[model samples]
Target: MVEETIKLAYGEYSDLIKDKRIAAVQALSGTGACRLFADFQKRFSPNSHIYIPVPTWSNHHNIWRDANVPQRTFHYYHPDTKDLDFASLMDDVKFSQNAPKGSFFLLHACAHNPTGVDPTEEQWKEMSYQFKVKGHFAFFDMAYQWFASGDPEKDVKSIGIFLEDGHLIGCS
Candidate 1:
């Protein structure tokens, strides 16, 4: 099941999988996966903080909090236009002085909760570039992988973009 899941999420022909670079474990659900990752982060990167988007899934706070991981919020939705706060989000991801380089970030791969606002393909590409520049780690919560586009391949475009850019991402 883990092997099949990795193929489903990362592409069947993914070089990462072919090279046996992925480390994975089975979890009960998205929440479980996230909690495990949070605990792993706390144990491994003790001094690092996770940057979560504002207005993310409500349980995200508790998951990280219980793991004893410090948290910070980055811009995501702009209520004025009822759309993505792209510029502000980019600034937070790329230029935030408080967040050190190589910080961990939790992102909704598709069908973002609460706002249901997903970034455009171009926006995701730019985000991938900026993340590379900042050396940030993207940890995608992909529970709604087939919700946005009704096609797993299309819905995971954001993750594909990050992978194509040579990022070692985390997906649940």
Candidate 2:
């Protein structure tokens, strides 16, 4: 079962692994990936908190909380508009001026479920810059990489931004 899952995740995340571009691994699924990442974060950066986006997949909160990692939230969806709250998000990110150096962040790779809202490419680039300035580590869960556009690569646009910034990445 684990091997099969690995094969599937590898096939889906091949671009990063084959290119020696990312330190990658296989996970049981999205939940497993998040759990593993949370564990890793807690293990190495014991004092850092994880910045989760508001309105993210609920299980994300559970996974991190269970791992005993402190959690923080940044703005995400706009309830009034039923879309991304880009300005509010940027402001919130900017406000995170003290999220600890080398802290961890989790990004939903694509096809944000339930709400179905995603950040624009420009916004992702800006977020990547913010992560860089804050010295945050990104652990991406690309579970639905092919669902957003029926093109796996296109679905990982957010991950692409982190890569462009030369940040070490872990994808599943």
**Considering every candidate listed, which one attains the maximal lDDT?**
1
Over the stretch 54-122, how does candidate 2's per-residue lDDT look in tens digits? 888889889989999989887788999999999887776666574556667777778776578888898
- Determine which window of 10 residues in candidate 1 has minimal summed lDDT: 9-18
Error in Å for residue 94 of model 1: 1.5
Question: What TM-score does candidate 1 reach?
Answer: 0.96
lDDT comparing candidate 1 with the true structure: 0.92
Model 2 pairs whose backbones collide: none
Error of 1 at 76 (Å): 0.2
TM-score of each: 0.96, 0.83
Tens digits of per-residue lDDT, candidate 1, 1-172, equal: 9989988898844888889989989998999999999998999889989999989999999999999999999999998999999999998988769567899999999999989999999999999999999999999999898899999999999999998898988888
Error of 2 at 121 (Å): 1.0
Clashing pairs in 1: none
Taken over the whole model, the C-alpha lDDT of each candidate is: 0.92, 0.76
Candidate 2 Cα deviation (angstroms), residue 141: 1.7
Worst lDDT run of 10 residues, candidate 2, spans 2-11
